[model samples]
Target: MSSRQDEVPTLTQPSEATRRPVIYDVTRIVTRALNAAPNGIDRVDFALARHFLARDNSARGALICTAIGPRLADPDLALETIEGVETLWREDGDAEADDVYRRVVEALGSKGFSGASPTRARKTPNLLYLERNWRAMRRWAPHLGRPLRQAPADAIYFNVTQFLVDRSWYMRWLATRPDVKPVFFVHDLLPIEAPEFFRAREALLHPRRVSNICRYGAGAVVGSQALARRLRQYATEKGRPELPICVARLPVSPSFLSPAEPPEAFGGVNYFVVCGTIEPRKNHLTLLNAWRALARDPAPPKLVIVGKRGWLNDAVVEMLERSVVLRPHVIEAGGLSTPGLRRLLAGARALLMPSFAEGFGLPVAEALAAGTPVVASDIEAFREVGGDAIDYIDPLDGLGWLQAVRDYATPNSPRRRAALERNTGTVAGAEEFFAKIDEFIVRL
Candidate 1:
């Protein structure tokens, strides 16, 4: 078993002359159990922390680990802690628990399903579970060293994950630090732009988060030009016309670049993979419906759904749990390791992403990096990342998606052949991404 360090890009030490004063707020990486499956933002935060430490070998670069309150720590120590946690995270023990639960549920028959009914007063054990985790996490707090006494420099970088923007204390602390400039990485404006897909509370909170960024941030980094433009428009509307915004597209994770033996999960069967959380915005229902239509076909290809269940997706859950037609064809692989995901993508007929919206589509880039075909939504972010290499279709076009999937599923697919031809040569690497960020920092 190769470690994650072997698979993901690591920051190499830079010349002393090029190092700058930078502090990374690693609140998300430290607090979150990232060893379990991490979403896109978590990956970005983790990568950014590593990348920042790589730039400087001395105290000029530091990492601040915070959960509700900020704490300053040695960058090296933070990195070590992050690596340790990630190693432990990769050895996720959820599968064993899930297997046990499955056995219990199976034994109970329909009663197992009925136990989760709305009529029953749910016994909330989550609070107790959280308390246990919190106690364990507190053991690491001693190693966090001390609270941030003062800003290290004139500028600081924060890539807000875990919705830390809404925390009043942190924002107030940031506001008071007039000497320090905050450069934030705005992954997306999805909550504000497409509020219907998110919870009402999140929709309400996101505007405030964006407003705070505009007010307190020295500059903002966006993954796409489209997002950068959107941020500028938002800032201007909020009376910050001259807010500095730059485009620094995210790089493909090095794990996806490594070669892997195709997993036996596919059993040599041609299958299409849909990566990311199963949520309303990802349009999983559309894919499920299309698969339902294809179920009648004598030689239909398999569809592998590769993400954990997320909120506002009861319909998708019901279909996955109860649909007879989808049962044989659709495989829900919720917890795949990085290596497993790379192997799955590498062996797939094509990566299918029918997202209704996106800030930056990482999976599209990852599939291209793995030399696999991609059939993604015709969104600007996908276009920016995939260029002419991908096959794009409207997310709502059920027949169109079904047809594209069928075409690519063919043994000798022209679309697949074209994707292979176009995806040749390296996709963007972290070196370029870091260079752009470094250049932006210097300009600041």
Candidate 2:
């Protein structure tokens, strides 16, 4: 099955029927593509780009915020930038064709999947790409995109990615052009609410981002109901009144949603997976401690941590780098493609996520959507997104997590069977999510 999450272009000849024109912003995706892989927020940005820019939808355009200010990108330039991101993420590639991804899949039902480094280092999409892209953009500036003066009346300036939230100059034009309604997607209030989890600069930057949303935004979008409620409360505390919000639960890609053969049926040692950044907030220490203890078993279930190493986790890095006890049972699979991740999750006994906090637990949802069981932290956001289906436990209760892991790792475990029987997780379709977004725009 293919994933809608990877598609970029989605506009229908730019509607000319006096309907509100949407100026979809792809600035963040364009810039972020030069460095890293797409995260959850990046995926949402791509979805919105597809939704607003559909060839049959409306007469819309794209926006890119430069060092000086926000400027619209012409037709050719916009398409070029989007395609570059699509290609860089391997959105259209054959996952098994790559040896690294093949090993990621192979490790699934084995005693444990040992992660592999690529034989040849992947090419970097660096500054040179950006330099070339900007040059091409300049040449196409006079094409389909027009200046602010020529923009359609009451056009909606929609930016799903919080690309230039800190800078007021990029959005200052909204003050001058009241006809353009500025709508934004607020991914999380994490940096503000959980300041300890992030850097000090981020804590300071988050307030300004939320304040900007309150000061200028006509409407907002959030991934979970818990997050939506929190955003509303935060905005109200900041003196914002009755902000219109659209609560759209993020969708799982088709790769994860498709049915897969369970690990129990694969006739191999059962393994479990933990997905997310290796940071303090993710509570990797607890999992590491638990895995270290599990390693004493004759054949402990393998623990595959699927995500790139993130910031501010010296202890996590230390343990990963130098724990002789952990070497046999743990695999740091940080760079598997989307399909590879889906396969890994599908064959796992359970998706173990003991995060300290989250705006939305996408991996938990992905696991359940794939018909894989989940052992998650007992948090409000997880409760809302995963409901009764999750095997919820306190993030700090070492004994509880240890016992749950032991049970899930066992073959033909009754607890796992019961949980899967009662699981109610369903992946939302691409059109279903976009339909809600469309309705939100109409109401706005």
Candidate 3:
């Protein structure tokens, strides 16, 4: 690898359409577990890919698949490859089979599969699930052609999700490619800023990822201006003061825009919903404790937690599993469909987001777009996206959160009325978001 430079290249004039084919990196999506639903990053990846495919005739965009580990050089994934994957992703792929496999995996993992003996008998069900998905993908693999031997000199490499950042070898190899210009979309610097919230390995590796972007990327994109400023500071600190940065707001997906009836789970009762993974930085504990305090009310508002369990959140998980007072009021609606989540948000008294930190509060934006009230942390990112439309509070202030929740729960509450009045419509959509990106690419 070349020595780290203090300067990076600036965006040049627009190139001819044929010379500037945008190659989107799909290493993350291609390798995700088949049964898993799309998360924040996943949604961004799919949205960008879908937009490119929709405009294939007008724009020169292609999806390229790259492996993360040792054997990094792989052929470009064909257009049909993305189509097949999108089909499975959108439909959730053989629901019954996925459910069965998920149950088996969950049951085994809960039973200490991590420490289980390396015996074939113990691995049978796990292997069976993998084999089934493998065979299904194999049937579609033939339709997706092999990767290309080389890319064009002026091709642009766009990585929206920052996949494989820890594997510096692969990223460095791509960076050194004289023919392609690499651009990365940095979601956040949380791992570097608040290392305690993430695993030790990630805390160690994330700095390298930022360093790589500063050293080799043609430019960087951020979801909010707050993140853009953070990246600039990091670049200056690393002695790469010339790094180019762009700020583009992420779009609320169309699914979140549509109106729907509340799901039957609510049972005609008013509830507050909190979306996102159960993790330390999310501050689920604060909400849990507040709900515990409110349990004394004969008719306290229900709390709905929508997201799967994430790493480093054993305390929150324990509370969810064992707290008697929380049992009746809290609903763990993990694996909710996009439509289901939209309805839940639409019907909620308010969406409670007491996250200690955030790159971009998608759920908060989604809730506001759905005309649902929001009671969130007074973080910069939330302030950027939500402005004064949300009821902001200090993430650590449990009493403040309880009061906000209570105000929203009361019928004809002034806070709730104000939030509803401020709901003009959906803020932004995929088209507008991608248009900004496309313009940025053109300028590059």
Q: State the lDDT of candidate 3 residue by residue for 1-444, as single tens digits.
A: 111221223334423332356766655655653644557877777777665554444344453332323222222333444455444444333322333223322322231122222211111124544555566455434433333334545667777776766566666556456677778888899999999999998889889888888877887887887887788889989887767776668888676676656644445566788989888999999999999988887677777777778889999878877776676666665554565567567668999999999999889888888888888999999999998788889999999999988888888899889987876665877765765676566556
Model 1, 382-430: lDDT tens digits are: 9998988888999999999999888888888887798788876467788
- lDDT of model 1, residue 24: 78
Q: Which stretches of candidate 1 lie over 4 Å from their true place?
A: 1-18, 54-68, 91-136, 141-147, 160-162, 264-267
Model 2 lDDT at residue 168? 79
Winner by lDDT: 2
Q: What is candidate 1's local distance difference test score? A: 0.70
- Compared with the true structure, all predictions reach lDDT values of 0.70, 0.73, 0.68
Q: Best TM-score goes to which candidate?
A: 2
lDDT (tens digit, per residue) of candidate 2 on 1-444: 112211223344323322668888867765654544567887788767876766433567777766446776653456666676665566556555434455544454445323342111122344654566555545444444445666667777888877778777777888888978888998888899889999888889888888998888888878887877788788788787567777777888777766655434346766788888777799989988998888877778877787777879999888877777776577667555566677677778899999989998888878888888899999998998888899899999988888898998887999899889878766677766776666666555
Query: Candidate 2 vs candidate 3: which has greater lDDT?
Result: 2
Candidate 2 has an lDDT of 0.73
TM-scores, one per candidate? 0.83, 0.87, 0.81
Clash counts for all predictions = 1, 16, 2
User: 193 in model 3: Cα distance from truth in Å?
Assistant: 0.7
